[model samples]
Target: MIQVRIKPGVEDRIRGFFPWVYRPEIISYSKQPKKGDLVVVRDYSGRFLGYGYINPSTNISIRIVSFNKEEPIGEELIRKRLKDALDYRKRLSLDSNAYRLVHSEGDFLPGLIVDVYGEYAVVEFTTYGMRSFKDWVVKALVELLKPKGIYERVSDYVATIEGVEDKGGILYGDVPEEVTIWEHDLKFLVLVPRGQKTGFFLDQRRARRLIRNFVKPGDECLDLFCHTGGFALNMKRAGAKKVTAVDLSEEALKVGKKNASLNQMSDVEWLEANAFDFLRKMHAEGRRFDLVVIDPPSFAKNKASVPSALRGYKELFFRGLHVTKPGGYLVVYSCSFHIRREHLLQTLLEASKDVKRQVRIVGESIQDLDHPWMLQTPNTLYLKGIYAEVL
Candidate 1:
């Protein structure tokens, strides 16, 4: 195996069990390593650190596979990790058919994501190192779960970030153009072939459940950025009198309508328009809702654009506050890692000031327990939500 030697004093992070080895931490290499090559890492004093897969092109030099000196990184290790992931889902009793089976680093399987929707699963191989083990992993999943279909959703941006041009697609079982799944007693229609991120936002499953608690019978609800209508359906089931769901993607709207129909919910109105534009139009038309839900897509993928993302979030919240009746409830959310709970709350405070509305925060929540956060990695705790009542 190739050897990677760390710079002096940089071995502390490795000893602390951090998975990533940054570029600046490396002092020297015993051999030129290719992408996806198995590498043995050591400290400057020649102490064994860990074993990992090397990616020379990216800033993340090594993604640790094992810290045990005698254990080997092979198909057995992959099978163990995959099995543990499956067991976790089962333990949570997460409706079985539609949920995140594996969440990359959260499950200790760095650079891999597997989302199961009914009898099908969508896999995303984000790094070259993970891509190298794709075939073995797929085989292991097939033997263990025996899902009806498996599909690859890897695309161009994933390749650009990993510094490789290889894009992955359906590698094993056949995946259909569309698939139906269930979440919290509601059936949803998903377009696996073209929908966003494994055909749904499984991370917000718990948050949608929380919305049900706030909705009341005969309440008018608005679900903004209602991709696939998860929140809308939940609100309707919670006894909301009517639901208006808005999104920019016509494809998403189509799925949203179908999902509503699948649940035998006919009181939902699906609108194919930009959420920001639709909110402004609703305000102009003197339309107000008893409960407003704002769950927009992540505006900033990194720190550089966090300010602009905050501005977008502020604008949405400001508009939602305006269209909400006095004493009505508002549920706002931000999925950007750069936007923390503090920043999100502060942004909403500023929005309230600008809109000249007084609001009382009634509740706050984050992603479900399924998406566990590493103690050292705060970025994994990305979702922030607030439930406020207009005053």
Candidate 2:
């Protein structure tokens, strides 16, 4: 394996188990590294740091997989990691058959994501290094879980960034377009091939369940970015009178309608429109909801977009606050790791000041236990929700 050494002062972070090594952090290399090259990382003094794969062109150059000098990166390590990830999921509450089985760095398998829907599984290789071990990952999943099928869903951005071909399709067995999965008592339709982020937002399982507590019988509720109506169905099941579900994707809303009908729920009003415009229009029309959930997609994909993301959040909060009835529940979520919890809180405070509406935080939630994040790698803990009572 190629040996790579980092600059001084970077050894401490590696010692602390921080997985990523930036491109600029390197001082010297044993040889010219190629994309997706397995290399041994070392400190400036030539002390062994960790074993990782090198992506020469990317900003995040090396994604460390094994910190142990003895435990090198190989197929055995991949198998062990997948086994551990599955074990962690088994310990979690099995209320939903659909859940995140491997959450990239959260499971210490950086660049790899695996989500299970019923008896089938979906895998995504976001980095060139992880894609090299696709065969091993698929074999491990089949041997461990014995799933009916395993599908590979690679994104266009990942392909371009990692310099890998978009090889997204059924890796093993047959995968259906749609699969029905249960969360608590409510059922949802997961679009495996075409849906967002591995078909469903499995990280928000706890948040969706927690939403039931704030909803009352005959309460008017609004679900923004209501992909497949996960929150909308839950609110209806909780006996909400009128639930308005809004999303930009007509395909998502179509599935949302199916999910609502799957649960025998017909009171939900599904709308295909941009959530921001819809919220502003509703607020202008004097529409007030007893419960409102603004769970938008990641507004910030990178650090550069954070400023605009915060502005978007502020505007959404301003509109969301005004549309929510007095003393009603308002839940705002940010799935972007770039937008920290403090950012969301600060945005909420600023929006409250601008809108002249005070809110008391009633609840807080992060990614589900199945999607465990390490303290060293905060990016794994991407999803966060703040539940507040508007006053």
Candidate 3:
């Protein structure tokens, strides 16, 4: 087996059960190995630590597969990890047919994510190590769940960072051009074969349910950054007076309208525009709504950008508050791990003060139970949401 030695004093992180080994922490290696090679990791004192997959091209040089020295990284191990992930979902009993089954390191399976939509599963390989096990993992998933289809949604950065050249597509059974999924009794047509991040943002599943309950009958609702109209459809189903879904992707808007039609929901509007621009325009035009949902993609990918991301959040929320009627509901959410709960709360507070509006928190939520978080790894819990009333 290839040997990887950590620099002096750097073993504490591994000893504490942290999964990643950065390149700067490495002392030496017995041999230069190909990407995704299984290697034995040790401390500077030659003490055995764990086993992990190595990718020299990335700063995250190693991702620990097993801490036990005797444990092997094989088919059985993959089966066990996959089983654990599935069991967690079963326990949660999420009503939505579409949800995240595996959440990378959160599931103890680094660099891999699996989103399930009914009988179809979309897997994303985000590292060289996971990409190497693509076939085995897919086969294991097939043997276990026997889904009707399995597809791949590869991140372009995965190839650049991990030295993984392959961009993902169907690696197994046929994946339909569009897969129908259920969210709160509403039908949504997801373009899995060519859509964003496993075809939907399953992380926001529970939050959407909250929106459904909070939105009263005949209430005008606005879903910003509404990819494929998940929130809009749910609001319409909950008897909203009108639902307008806005997204930059014309393709997504087309599908969003189709999804509304699929569920036999009328009075739903679709707009293709930049969310930030649209919000500013709405504020200037004095457009007000009974309820607004702001679910933006991650603006903070790294620690350095977190402050700016929070500023962006504040601006968005402030604009949202400006356009919402007094006592109206606002559902704000952030998927960036770097944006902590306190930071989000602070941003909302600042936005409220800026708009001179009194805001009361009605509800707060984190990632669903299926996305388990290790005790020490708070970063794994990335989803944070708040339901506030502007008064």
Candidate 4:
């Protein structure tokens, strides 16, 4: 075992259960620290703090997985954590087979993500350290879930940053190219091998279900950045006479059309255009909808990108408001963790002031219950949607 000591004042935060230790906060190591080695963390005075895996090259150098000195990191501990996560989800009764099984730090299993879809599971390891426990993770999942197969989804950028191989494929059993899963009388075809964010945005299940309440029969609806038609299908199913789903990817539009056909909703209009351009076109054409959903991809990935990301969000808000009909509803979402709830609210306020339309907030929503967030790690609560009425 390797020993790691932190700087004088850094021990306070570690005692308070903050899981990350930045490289600058570390004072000394028992030896030259390896990139992905388990280490025993200690305070400046040589007091035990926690046990975690070390990534010496990154800014976030340490991610503590165990704070109890009695409980060491091993196969048994890993199995216990997996079983506990499964137990937690069983209690949620998410009403759908597709849900996040392991939410990284939310489950005290940093650097890993697991999403279940029907009889298959998709796993991702975001850190070089957690990659070492792949065998243990797979074995536990097989024993617990008894899924038909397990697939891996890896990000190229994360792989480069974490010094891991940038490869993705089936890790266990056999996975199909597509899987059909149902959610609240709705069935979605998940393209696990090539779809976005582990086949679907499972976190937005609540919002998809909630949007039905605000819709009226025969109302026109717009779903911008509508990847694979999650919101669009829901809007149409809610009795919207016409639904327009726009996305930049033609591939996604094809899938959306297929999804529409799957639900017998072939009437939905799939448009292959960038969301901003489509919004501008709608405004120019004097086209207005009863409900508009602005759910775009994360504009900011890290703290340094927050300012520019806020600017992008402000532009979307401005366009979304102008494109919405008077007395209609507008829903804007920011999936970036850096874009906090306050940031989204402030952006909406500024956009409203500029558009000269008084905005009335009707409802606010976060990621569904399946994606549990911890107060200690605000980043865990990444998805935020603001529903407002244009007065």
Candidate 5:
């Protein structure tokens, strides 16, 4: 293994359990390192910090997997981490069988994600080093969960960044294109091979269940950027007389409609169009809803995109507020790590000031319990939703 020394004062963060070491933080290396090489990181004084894998080409050059000097990075260690992650999920006792089993850094497995939908598991290896442990990961999951199948879903960007091929599809056993999973007694069709972020947004499981509280019988509801009608069906199931779901992808809308029917939910209007445009049109047409949820996809992928992401949030907040009836509920969410909880709250405050609506925040939601976050890595806490009453 290569010995990597960090610049002075950088070891304190690693000591604090922060897993990432940027390229510029390296002071010296015992040898020229290759991409995805196992390394022992050390402080300036030659004190061992952790064991990690190095990717010389990426800005985030190293992702620490084992912080204890006694523990080394290997198949056994990976299996142990997977077991721990699985144990944590088992303790969560999530209402739904579909959940995030391993949340990358949250599970101390820096570059892997595992989501379970019913009897099947979906995996994504976001880094080259993690992909190298594919056999170990799959074996551990199978032994622990006895999942009927395991599917691999790799992103093109991650593939390019890690210099790995995109081998996205079934990795083990038989995987159906669509699988029905139950959440809070409601059945949803999860498109494992095709849906976004492992079929459904399992992180929003709690928020989807929480939305029912704000809805009243015969209330009109709008679910913007509603992928697969997670919120729309819940609102209808809660007795909303009418619910409108809008999204950019017709495919998602098609699935959303199917989900509505699966739950025996009626009067849900699925609209395939840009949510921003749809919101603007609704506002222009003097449309208003008793409840509205604006759950857009991650707008800021990195720190540099934060400003534009906030602007996008502000626009959606404004439109969502404008179309929300007085005393109605409006929920807005940001899935970007760059967009913090404070950013979403501040944007809502600013939007209320401009829209001239007195808003009272009623609730705030983070990613569901299954997607556990770490204090050392704030980025692990990504999804945030603010539910407010427009007065």
Candidate 6:
């Protein structure tokens, strides 16, 4: 293994079990490091830090897998990690048959994502280093879960940034274009090969169940960025009289329609348009909803874009507030790790002050148990939602 030493004062973070090592933080390498090579990361004084794989070309240079000096990165370690991830999932008795089998850093296997949709599993390798262990990951998934088929999904970031040529296909067995899965009495058609984030937003499984508590029969509801209508379907299932589901992706709305039909509840009004534009249009039209959910894609991909993301959130909240009926529920979610909970709260505060709408927070939710967030690595906790009642 190659020995890589970091600059001074950087070891404290590694000691706290922070997984990533930035490119510029390293002082010297024992030898010339390759793009995806197993490295023994060390302190400036040559003390052991952790064992991880290095991507010399990337900004996040090293992603540590094993913090214990004695436990190195090997086939055994890989198998153990996969087993740990599976065991954690088995413990959760969720109503959903589909869930995230492995959540990248959340599962302590950074750069690897596995989302299970019934008999099939979709695997994504986000980093060059984790890509090297693709065979091991597939074999372990087969041995443990014994899924009928395994499909490889290549993200654009992996293709562009990591430069992996494989355009994603069936790695093992046969994976169909669409797979039907159920979540808490609601059935959905998951586009394993083509759908967003392994067919459905499995991270919002908890939110789907929780939103039922706020919904009432004959209540008008709005689901923004309604990818495959996860929340909209849930809202309808909970007996909402009218539900408006909006999204830019016609493909997503198509599947969402199928999902609504699959559940035998086809009343969800699916609209194709940009969510931001739709929110403003609804406010302009004086259309008020009993419950409004603004669950948009990550506005900020990095820290530098956070300011712009906040401005975007402020506007969304302002419009969302106006569109929400007085004494109705308004839920906002931020999927970006860069956009912290405090940022969402502050934006909500500003939006409320500008709109003069008194609001009280009803509840909060994070990613489901299937998507575990490590305390040491704040980045693992990426999904957050705030449920508020407007007065």
Instruction: State the C-alpha lDDT per candidate.
Output: 0.86, 0.92, 0.87, 0.91, 0.92, 0.92
Candidate 2, residues 1-391, lDDT tens digits: the string is: 8999999999999899999999999987889999989999999999899999999999999999999988998889999999999988888886999988898888899999999999999999999998989999999999998999999988888978887776699999999999999989988888899998799998899999999999999999999999999899999989999999999999999999998888888889999999989988998899999999999999999999999999999999999999989999889999999999999999999999988998999999998888889899998889999999999
> What does candidate 2 score on TM?
0.98
lDDT (tens digit, per residue) of candidate 5 on 240-320: 999999999888999988888787778999898999999899999999999999999999999999999999989999998
Every model: Cα RMSD to truth: 1.5, 1.0, 1.5, 0.9, 1.0, 1.1
lDDT of 6: 0.92
User: Which stretches of candidate 5 lie above 4 Å from their native place?
Assistant: none
Candidate 6 residue lDDT tens string, 1-391: 9999999999999999899999999999999999889999999999999999999988899999999988898888888999998888889987888989888888889999999999999999999899999889888889988999999989887899987888989989989899999899888898999888667889999998999999989999999999999899889988999899999999999998888877888668999999889988888899999999999999999999999999999999999999999999999999999999999999999999999999999999999899998898888899999999999
lDDT (tens digit, per residue) of candidate 4 on 153-205: 98887788998875879999999999999988899999998988798999999
List the lowest-lDDT window of 10 residues for candidate 5: 163-172
Candidate 2, residue 42: how far the Cα is off, in Å: 1.0
**Model 1 Cα lDDT, one tens digit per residue, 40-156:** 999998899988998887888898878889776889998998998888788886653688888887877778888888888888988889889988889988987898888888767
TM-score of each: 0.96, 0.98, 0.96, 0.98, 0.98, 0.98
Tens-digit lDDT track for model 3 on 37-156?
Answer: 988999998999988898887888998888887776787888899998898888887888888889888888888899988999999888888888888899989987899989988777
Where model 3 places Cα greater than 4 Å from the true spot, the runs are: none
**Clashing residue pairs found in predicted model 1:** none
Error of 2 at 209 (Å): 0.2
Which ten contiguous residues of candidate 6 have the minimum total lDDT? Answer: 258-267
Using alpha carbons, what is the TM-score of model 6? 0.98
lDDT of 4: 0.91
